[model samples]
Target: MKLWIKLAAALLSGACTVASAQNFPNRPVRIILAITPGSVADAIARFMSQDLTARLGQPVVVENRAGGGGAVAAEACKQAPADGHTLCMLHVSTFSLNPFTMQRLSYDPFKDFKPVTRMFFINEALVVSPAVAARSVEELRKLLVANSGKFSYATLQLPGADYFQAGLSEQWGAQVIAIPFKGGGEVVTALLSDQVNIGYAGAGNFAEHVKAGKIRMLAVNAGSRLKEFPNVPTFGEAGIKPFKIKAWWGMFAPAGTPEEIVNRVNTELSRSLADAKVRQYVEERFMESAVTANPAEFASFVRQDYERGGALVEEIKRAAGNK
Candidate 1:
């Protein structure tokens, strides 16, 4: 009788676990945003959260825990229980570039998080202040070469955006100085204030500035011209061949979250991405929906991005010869 009772207890425990996993997210779900309120990241999170709330039958809330180049929010998500209730919207720079930029990182981009789905891709645009003489990408390259080291550009981050600018300078044989700012908003402010001759930032961040004639988008770092800015030539079209780098956003959960839960989230996110409202929201915001990928595919994409970013960092380190 003792043995039978033990067996029954074990089965009951297993059944309860299964039931809990199945019911998953029985309460409200929280999404941690690594950026401050009113930021582009926050805006995207809000849009997605609203859609998810309707689809999941649970309130989806976005909580901003901004700091440390997104490490703060990421760490918070990492420390959260490995339940589907707590998740984060991981940016490309945080997951892929931070590892290469920061000397010491707290969490493993891969091992510490389970990727759910890629939300959207925001391509960066290379824009010059109207005060600059250059109008097109080639013209800008020539102007930079002629002025060599006289031209300065601003980027949001040190090793991510600035590193890409460094690579562009090397590839184009231009002596451009890269100035770092706290965020994209500051970068735009500096460009508008004529504090910097050139700046690199997401199209969404500079859409109004570009429209206002405060900045001229010379070339876009995308395979082709974006739908919103079709008139603006791509880097390739402007003779700056092989210049494509897209900043992506994706959903992630704490590592060790149940596979079933992760799959459920991924499925819902995938559906959300496909919804006309979501697509329209992204389009209006100058973002493009990335092709939907499952957990394995998202993991592979993150790994590839990490490797690519690492290589870029190595090249920058070699060029600068700094520790």
Candidate 2:
């Protein structure tokens, strides 16, 4: 009699889990943003919410919890119930940078959340204000060396930007001040207003300004010259070896969420992102679609990135010391 009762209980528990997964998102679903509005992450989240809502039979909302280099949003996601209802849109900074740089991180990317899929990857570019007389990266490097300690570079509070500033300064035997901002939008604004003479961010951020002749794009990390600016050289072509790093935005669910539900969301995201509109949007934004094969694949990718972040942190510190 005891054994029968135990088996019944186990069967009921399994049934409950299955039901929970199937009925996932019975209410509104929220995708928290780790950065400020007007960022590429925000744009992509807002763009996909409608489609996700329709597919899930529930409203999908985007909430910005920007600050602390993605800590605020990450904490919110970590504290949320381990259900499919709450998700977060995190980026390279959250998974790759903060773990190694922050003195105290509130959550672990691997322990606190489940990676759904990588949404997109962006390539960084070096842009200078029109006030600067450099037309190309070589020219800019010479200028920086000649005018050491006379320039300031604007960056989002992430290691990638700071790493570049440090690496370039050491390479060119120059010293450029680093001014950190809260978001990409702020960095772009600073560059546009000439508040900073140098800026490093997604090439998309400076596309229009470059066209307007307000800023000059010296080089990009896109592996080749951009189609839009055929004359602009890649970092490799400009004489800098390719930086072995990636900047991507990915979706995550609170840890302990059912694998079934996680797969469901991943499937929907894949379908939604396959739309022609999304592809066009990605291209226009100067990004590449980076949907992973599955959740496990994304998890593996994160683990690799986390390791890379640690090594890069050490390299960044060394570069800073050399500067």
RMSD to the true structure for each prediction, in A, is 3.2, 2.4
- Top of the candidates by lDDT: 2
What lDDT is obtained when candidate 2 is compared to the true structure? 0.83
> Deviation in angstroms for 291 in model 2?
4.4
lDDT scores of the candidates, listed in order? 0.80, 0.83
Query: What clash pairs does model 1 have?
Result: none
Question: Taking the tens digit of each residue's C-alpha lDDT, what string does model 1 give over 1-323?
Answer: 99999999999977876787799879999998876665565777899899999988899999887666678778998999887999898787777678878878888888889999888887678898999998887788888878878988886655443556766666766767777664567778888899999987677778888888888998787767887678999877877655334578889999988888899999999999899988888767777779989999999998888887777766766766532
- Backbone clashes in candidate 1 total 0
Pull out the clashing pairs in model 2: none
Lowest lDDT 10-residue stretch of candidate 2: 157-166
User: Deviation in angstroms for 10 in model 2?
Assistant: 5.9
TM-scores for every predicted model: 0.87, 0.92
Candidate 1 error regions (>4 Å): 1-16, 243-245, 321-323
